[model samples]
Target: MGIVLNQSLKNTIITYLGFGIGAINTLYLYPVLLGATFYGLTNYITSCANVIMPLFAIGMQNSLVKFYSQYKTIDEKSRFLSFTVLFPLVLIIPMLLISLYFYDEILYFLSKKNEIVKYYVWLIPFIGLCMAYFEIFYAWARVHMHSVFGNFVKEVGLRLFSLLLLIAVNFDWLTVEGFVYATAGLYFLAFLVTMFYAFGIQKPTFQFAMPSNSKEILTYTFYIILSGSVANLLLDGDKIMLNQYMIIDNIAFYSIATFIALVISVPSRAMHQIVYPITAKLMHENKFEELNVLYKKTSINLQVVGGYVMLGIFVNINQLYAMIPKEYSGGLLVVFMIGISKYFDLILGNNNAIIFNTKYYRAVLFLGVLLVAVAIGLNMLFIPLYGIMGCAFATLLSITLYSVAKLLFVVKRLHLYPFTAQTLYSIIITFILFILFYFWEFPFTPVLSIFLKALLITLIYVYINYKFVISTEINEAIDFVLNKIRK
Candidate 1:
């Protein structure tokens, strides 16, 4: 438990470091320089690539993590690793070829406005291949417990490069076309860096002789692809559908709203990276007691950490929106809706990592697919009437359903519960903080007000959690800080 908590903390620090860079790139610079429509185009392009990558990936990336520990000899593991890279290439080549053939009709249906749709034709493949391989190598690194480097590449490396490119555009050093090209190029570079790092750890050699377990791996990959596709639909499908049914600028607005809300997932993201492989190992060893402990601690720890972020965002939403133009300010409702949705996910703890890496992943994913379909249907019906807000409501409803379904599955199957008195106490504390800070007026510039409010809310949240001992995990964290000060 202590080791897992320590790893989770380290992962959170690096993850947030990446997100700190992303927060600036996504929330501020991209919107300021690119404007909403162009920003939407960038977000849309990335989202499309993400959705497509997992499809063509043929699930080898996931198979990499699950199978790595099973191989006794390094030679055996190397063969599995080689297949991880090759299988995806074989699958992705045909998928890309088919996509290129149908590019025009696909673009026509995906875009309501023709202006940016043309870019998608070529961009999709570049983005898809870059994203797919990024995950492939990232999975390799993760199984080795070297997840932080790949995370830095993902969280900080790409955004930092994009920030520079956006600055270049602002000074008229590059055109939007150049910036888009640069953005797409950065993703490939990030993937390359990840691959290089992965190779440093374990240089995979392509060998022809099939492993006796090749058929077993292929079967697992097939199920995982279905699972991955449904997961992407839940996460990325909203932006894709919004782009299809509405204008590009609308996606920009939705992108910003979603970006703001997505912050709540940062803690979970960091924790999950380390937790996934560990949980997989535990399950493989039939260590259900250890897994149960992990599930509860992660849920509590994530809730405590993510709850503070949600409180900060909700309390200071008005001031935060003031940082952006008024055109983007109307996204506050979207922010709240999505923020709440992420909050629900946070409370579910590592329910996702637990379920996705376990034997019962397919069943949980099927339930997720059902909810995702509802989200699509709702967004299709309502986005025309309500625009980004419709998208927000659809996302909120769908995410809530998805999170609840995940929680239920974990509980019923594992006989585990993440909720406790501490969970209720955290909720009460967040609500109280929200009410108190909700009405308080800090007379400062919008930018300054956000900083001041965030600081105060963070301090109060920690103090309250410490005072109440919200969870043993956070209490121990506080104690560690205090002990260092005393020493």
Candidate 2:
């Protein structure tokens, strides 16, 4: 927990910093500078890329994390690392060739509804390939317990560059189309930087041979591909669906609301970087007792922190929407729906790591695939009736159902659960805070009002959690920060 805490805190700070920049870009600059249509197009390109990224990488990122700790000899580890690096190319090359062969068909399918997407259709695979390799290398770093630097590059570096690019657009240095192309270049740059950093951490021996456990490795990688696709589909499939069913500008609105809601997941995202490899190590060693302890601790800890984030956002959602454009304000319901779903995911803690590392992962992945279908079906059914709000409803329901299924599967199969008494207490605290803050606001401008309200909420939330000691780990963390401040 000590290493997990140290690295998780750093990753959390880096992630929030990135999200802050993303908020500025998504909520203000993109809308203000590029206008809603191009803003939506920009998001649409990235969302489509993310949805296809797993197929390109063929699951090497997850395979690295799950298998890296199992090898005892450096030669064996080197062989495995080399395999992870090289294996994805087998699928990537063929996929690119296929895309080239079917280029016109692909463009027609993507642009049938929206012609603006036709010009940018090529960027999806290019960017997805970059994203895929970046994760493969980023996973390379995580397996060695060197996640902070990769995380900094991932969370802070890309968003910071995006901020600069938007400013470039503002200064008339780059046209909007150029901004889109340059963003794709940024993805490539991120991949290159991470690849070099990963090599710096463990200079790749670049063996031509496969790992000794090639059969097991290949099988796991196959399942991971499905799992990764399912996960990404859950995250970004709605946006792609929106591109299909609605106008491109609506996606910009959905993007804004979703971005605000996504801040709740930052703690889970941060903790997963460190906790995932540790969970893999524990599973490899058959350390079920330690694994169980970790399961409970991560659950309660993330719940406390994620609850705070969700609370802050939900309570102050009005002010947040106020700061954005009026047309985008209709996404208020999207925020509530998506925010709750993200909070539900956060409380599951390392539930994903536990499932992914276990043998039952195949069954869980099958369930995930089914839920992806369900999600798409739901979106198709709802989008015509409602709008962006309908997409949000579909996302919320699909994610919640998926989350509950994962939770139940872990409990039924492993006999481990992520909840304790603290889970209930944390929920109660969150509920109370929401009721108290949701209906009131300081009579000031949105920025100042948000600051004062967030400050009040933070102080009160921290005090109650500290007093009740909802999580001993959280309490110790608070005390540690306070002691450092006193010195």
Candidate 3:
């Protein structure tokens, strides 16, 4: 448990480091150097490839984690890993080929004008394959409780490599076409790095022995594909939708704001990766009480961390955008909506993981697909009328519905609820903090005002939490930091 906590702390730090680099690249460098449209195209293309990669993955990543413990022998695990690799490739390869065949048609349908879509067309398969295998390798590492390397590679390594590409563009060393290819190429490189690391650490062998359990594995994989696809679309569908309905520049503006908003999810992402297998192990042992405790702790802690992050970004948004050009500032609303949506998911803790790892996993995903369909329908109706704000609103509603449904399902099936008097208390405390700060606008430059506002909000919020103990979990976290500093 201590090791898990330490590794999580390390991963969280690295994720923020990566976020810092991304903040510079997406919000400042890309928009300043490439303009909003090209930046949007870059983001949309990368997200499209990402969203589609899971479709090819066939849920093998989650399946790998869920099924690994069932195999006791070393050889059995090896065969299982090999089969995991084979399963996703079998589907991913064909899908890539098909997409390639219809590349031109896809471009025409996705864009309003005959833009330089071909420059990035080849990246579809390359990125899709890269992303597919990255998840596979990460899953392989995760089952061994060695997730920090994968998290670093996935979260930080990609951003570092992308930062290099941005530097090239900023320095006039690469054209937009070159930048696009570089973006795709970086994922492939990161995948390779993680693969080598997995081999070094797990040294998983390349062998197959048709376990009698293979049938169960295959069935799980099949359902997981649908599940993975739906999850992918729910998260990544907005960029795809934006690409289809608007210009690349709009996507760029939206992407910049989305990047900032995504910072709010760092805590959730770090916690989830470590918590998933832990939760699965608890379920496997029928330790329902432990699972319940974990659910509540995770929800409260995640909200504590994510709330601070969202507060920082919200309080500093105007100054943050002032750092960028005026043209890209329209994404401010997108940032707020998406940030709230993601933080809301954080508030639900590991509800999705609980559902996916349980017996009712398939039904959970089926419901996810229905919600995703509604999300797409709403985006279609909204993106055209309200542009990025519409997409943001649609996403917020869809994810809220999805989170509520999952929460209800878990409460019914497991008889667990991740809320308490503290939850309501935190809400009230947060609201009062917002109200106190809302009326305290100072007469200063936008940049100065944002800096002062963020400082005051941080101080006031912290003081309130300390005074009221809105979250004992958070108070303890603060104590830990203070103790470390004293040392």
Top candidate when judged by TM-score against the true structure: 2
| Per-model TM-score versus the true fold | 0.96, 0.99, 0.95
Q: Model 1's lDDT to the true fold? A: 0.82
What's model 3's lDDT at 72? Answer: 83
lDDT of 2 by residue, 378-477 (tens): 9999998998989999999999999999999999999997898989999999999999999999999999999999999999999999999999998999
Clashing pairs in 1: 299-349
- Give all candidates' CA lDDT scores: 0.82, 0.94, 0.80
Candidate number of the best lDDT:
2
**Candidate 1 structure quality by residue, lDDT tens digits, 80-152:** 8887887777777787788778987877776646467675558877988888899999999999988888877
TM-score for candidate 3, please give it: 0.95
In angstroms, what RMSD does candidate 1 have relative to the true structure? 1.7
Clashes of 3: 3
Question: What TM-score should be assigned to candidate 1?
Answer: 0.96
Mind giving the per-residue lDDT tens digits that candidate 3 earns over 1-487?
Answer: 3554566677788889889888778777888777776777777777778777777777888888888877888888888888888766677678778877887787677655427555666676678778988998898888888888889888888988888888888788998768887787788898899889888877766765566687877777777777878777878888888877777777888888888888998988887777888887888788999899888888877777778788778767767787788988898989889988888888888887788778887787888889999999999999999999999999989988988888889999889889877777766766666666655656888778877888887887788767777667667767888899999
Can you rank all candidates by lDDT, best first? 2, 1, 3
Candidate 3 lowest-lDDT run of ten: 110-119
